[model samples]
Target: MQPLILHIPHASTHIPFKDGYLVGEELLQQEINKLTDWYTDDLFDSPEDITIKADFSRIFCDVERFVDDQQEVMAQYGMGMLYTHTDAGQRMREVNPTLRKQIKEEYYLPHHQKLEVAVKKQLDQFGHALMVDCHSFTDIPFERDLNKKVPRPDINIGTDPFHTSQTLQDLTLEFFTSRGFSVGLNWPYSGTMVPMAYYQKNRQVQSILIEVNRKLYLDAVTCTRNRHFNEIKSVLNQYLHLIRSNVNDIFYPINNES
Candidate 1:
């Protein structure tokens, strides 16, 4: 069946957050592993909240790492500051350029591109479609705030920063707000790397990348399921329903009144 709404949860770089050997991501993974089960069976499942594994692997620790353990430097290789090593202007030498390219092609690009093409295909079948990129981030301060782990806003709305319809944005804000979620606008996150379709304004479809603060349902240090996981999940299911019902109005203003 064609899908009117598409969600692209940005494919993670497999870099676990760590301090030295283990990065901060390891802590976060603990939380996700509880729910997703370490990429086992289904992409995600809730079958009895079963057992999972947590072995150490630096592979999931960084995306474009240029150094190895014991400070062995990788020879220079790649492009500008964007895709290059942590050191600005330094190409990650000796690092398999082919593998890095494959990571982007196989992991990141294809995943999102597939969603885009899927949305386009569906747009032809249906009148309108929307893509909402779902993501999560720690609400903890960058300066290592181990204390105030309070869950941030219940909802964050981004309408491509007023590039999309302001009416639609306002309506979206109201939609979430009415459902008893505390909403935030462009706070903690606005948007990043959201490619624009050549015919965005003309097309009868819409795409918005929405990032959720991960701290909502996971503890800051342990990354384990917090008390609010189910509560937040319940809200999201309803939010999806609201957006689907109201989407047509965003494109056809006449239909909104009718």
Candidate 2:
């Protein structure tokens, strides 16, 4: 088996509210459901791969954002590592510098650390690691989104020039496009995830961010899986198998057999 890491960062809905920090549990639940990737973890999960998922909601701690505000594009909207605004531009919670530091040390750092450890293990074992960041977005835009007016495609593939090569990008695009899904290079969202320590240093780590349109498999209003869920899941399973079959060539070409 080749080294593959399935990174599911936003499927969780659990929020630690015992500190009496949140306003209302009901509203929090709704917000979480709206912001979450829904059933993405289940959609991309493979029994043969190593999967690392966040245990809490992004509202509490977004492990995907760059730790530094200046480096994170979404920081301008107050949705950086620690979110201070809601999807509608309202105050989600007041997290001061001290509190933000606490959240990062407790949740953010550890989560990324887990990913780092996984990637390093893969690197040691196979000389490279393929990190597939799985996600799902609502068909319609949220109120505070910068590109709210723009239409989102069925599948948005986020890439990094350093980690995502043309071959991998083309293959991924073709795979989903051939499946009848409207694919976008980067529309509503862009960029891929890499561990902080290896951000610009490691070319052995290949990253791809996949954003599935919620309309494809979800009941938008109720936030539940629809009939299309199984079909999409099967499609994802096929893609995972394809990746496993071609891992060396697609990701680690240096190791490809002559």
Give all TM-scores, in the order shown: 0.59, 0.93
lDDT of 2 by residue, 211-244 (tens): 8899999998888899999999999888778776
For model 2, the local distance difference test gives 0.83
- TM-score between model 2 and native: 0.93
User: For candidate 1, lDDT tens digit of each residue in 118-234?
Assistant: 656656777555555454545543222223334567555655642355556777788777877676676555542233452335344555544455656666555456787777666
Question: How close to the true structure is residue 209 of candidate 2, measured as C-alpha lDDT?
Answer: 91
Q: Model 2, poorest ten-residue lDDT window?
A: 249-258
Instruction: Output the lDDT of residue 230, model 2.
Output: 95
Q: Alpha carbon lDDT of residue 72, candidate 1?
A: 19
Model 1 lowest lDDT segment of ten: 35-44
